[model samples]
Target: MNSTAKNCAALAKRLTDSGLRPTPQREVVFKVILEKRDHPTADEIFARVKSQMPTISLATVYNCLETLVQCGLVRQVNLERAPTRYCPNLHEHAHFHDDATGQVHDINLPADTLKQLRSLLPPGFDASTVELAFRGSKGSARAKLAEGRAAARSGAN
Candidate 1:
């Protein structure tokens, strides 16, 4: 099977395994989450899904999100004082939030770094999960262009 088909099958299996029925709404919601790895809020997801499935209701979307998160098919990224975002990345990683654009970027940590982080825990303290987040300004397209121009001028010196 192709990657898309494989992904769909995996999601369906997850729902089935989690004791949840993989309804059409749930499938579409899962697809939206996977298609846009931008970690969108529930409202953003509802808008996208509405385009595809105009009959879908916001309440239904919210319910679908809850079911997906409960099934481990999606992760809810809760930022302090911000709306929750849904993520489908099931790997161990950190998130960098661009305060300027309100975007979240996933950062894959090196195994060594993960090991060091775990080593910081006190003895006999078993930690199964870790959530690391960072906030900073992600340079804009205009800023990047200006930086490139500066580099070109400096190189010509």
Candidate 2:
């Protein structure tokens, strides 16, 4: 089978394993998420899927997203006071929310670091998942240059 067919089959198998039936809408939504690992909101996903499947409704996209999340096929990322976004990465990682660009990047954590974090919990407490997010501006080139110049002037004083 071709790559596209293989992907579809894999998606179907995953859905079935999760006791959910796979539909075209779900497949399309999954494809969009996998195509662009941009951590997009449901509306953004709707916009992208609509280009290919113009008949797709935003509600349908939302439903598909929920199903995918329920089935552990996608991760729901909630940034403070922002629309919920979806991520396809299944591995354990944190999120870096770029304040300036409004882009979300995955920050991979070392196994030891994760273990250290989990160890912080109390004896009777257990964490099923750990979510760590950092919000900051990924400085622009001009901003960095300005900072360098300002630092030089302050040092000369």
Candidate 3:
């Protein structure tokens, strides 16, 4: 079978395992999220789904997203005062919000780093999940130099 078919089958299996029936809307939304690893907001997802399934309503997209998140198939990344975004990556990682570009990048968290974070909790309080987000711009010298070179190259061409 083709990749799309395989993906649909996998989605069905996951949803069924989560005790939710997989519908076409849920499948499409999940596919869109999987297609683009970028953490996208509900509106962004609605727009993308609308293109393929013109009859899909924003409400339906929202419902599908809620189902996906509830079923543990997707994660909702909440940034302060910004729209909530969805992430398909199930691994343990943190998100870096770039203030300049308004983009979210996934930062891998090492096992020891996670252990250290969990260690900070009180003896009686156990943490199920730890979410760490850093808000800043990529203003490092290396990043600046790379941007300058790209601009110069583009201008030359």
How do all models score by TM-score? 0.50, 0.50, 0.50
Please, what is the whole-model Cα lDDT of each candidate in the order they appear? 0.88, 0.90, 0.90
RMSD to native, candidate 1? 17.5
Candidate number with the higher TM-score (1 or 3): 1
Give the alpha carbon lDDT tens digit for every residue of 1-157 in model 1: 9876787898889988887787889888988899979999999999999999999999999999989878777888873678888899987889999988889999998778988999999999988987789988887789999989998989955
Give the Å error, residue 120, model 3: 18
Tens digits of per-residue lDDT for model 2, 112-142: 9999999999899989998899988887789
Ranking by TM-score: 1, 2, 3
Write out the backbone clash pairs for model 3. Answer: none
Model number with the top TM-score:
1
lDDT of 3 by residue, 99-134 (tens): 889999999999899999999988999898898998
- For candidate 2, the 10 contiguous residues with the lowest summed lDDT are 72-81
TM-score of 2: 0.50
Candidate 1 CA-lDDT value: 0.88
**Candidate 2 — what's its lDDT?**
0.90
